[model samples]
Target: MSVVETLLVFAVIPLAIVLLFAVLTLLPGRAKKARYKPGQPWQYQPVWWEPHPLHGPAAGNHDDGPKAIGSSVYQEPQAIGSGHGSASHGATSHGSTSHGATAHGATSHGATAVGASAAQPAPVSAGPLGGARGTW
Candidate 1:
């Protein structure tokens, strides 16, 4: 083979591989801590991002009552990167809202009743101690 062709095959090919290895090794690996869990309820983290209040205002699609959506009846404290959670956070009793059963509960801001219209899965509450509570 011609010297040019031989050098192109051996030298250029090895150089390409070395470059590839260096590039791959230096790439920023996944952050040791990422905030994403698909197929599960929206996991909340109290991470102080640029824009707080993480979500937009609750829409008008109130399922049980006009006060169900944005009402302060139930709101759970976000347990984000703090790595802190506890079971003592307690739960809201649906018996206060209706005679029926529900899947989850909350504090000042939460879903208390699963009205006949919202017969779907109720919101699941991750207890303050990093665990799912109730049927949800």
Candidate 2:
């Protein structure tokens, strides 16, 4: 065989293969889908790092504007009612006003339920498998 042909067959092919492999590694590959795969059944695996579904904002629906609370539903902010001083100011005896506004019975905000602890699996112990020791 000619030296040029031997060089092309032996060196050029391997160099071309290596270059192609490097180019493929440099290019971004397809993103791995977390939800659905080709043949496997659809499964819902909850990731521990993500927010718990309970405390997140209401799903799908995003109309977060304030809604009607009591009667006189569409009144302007000034027309709604006056704010009586809160019970912390020792003013709990304010007469009931329009919309039954009162500082009394106000719920303390910022309270949350303690989350459950995720228990770890027990450790496996080594034991004799072949009919126990000295029984044979």
The 10-residue segment of model 1 with minimum total lDDT is: 82-91
lDDT (tens digit, per residue) of candidate 2 on 1-136: 9999999999999999999998898766645766555687755421112223332222432233111222211211121233211211122123212123222212122221111111212235558555546621
What TM value does model 1 have? 0.22
Question: How many pairs of residues collide in model 2?
Answer: 0
In order, the Cα lDDT scores of the candidates are 0.38, 0.33
Question: Which pairs of residues collide in model 2?
Answer: none
Model 1 stretches astray by more than 4 angstroms: 29-136
Top candidate, metric TM-score: 2
What stretches of model 2 exceed 4 Å from their correct place? 29-136
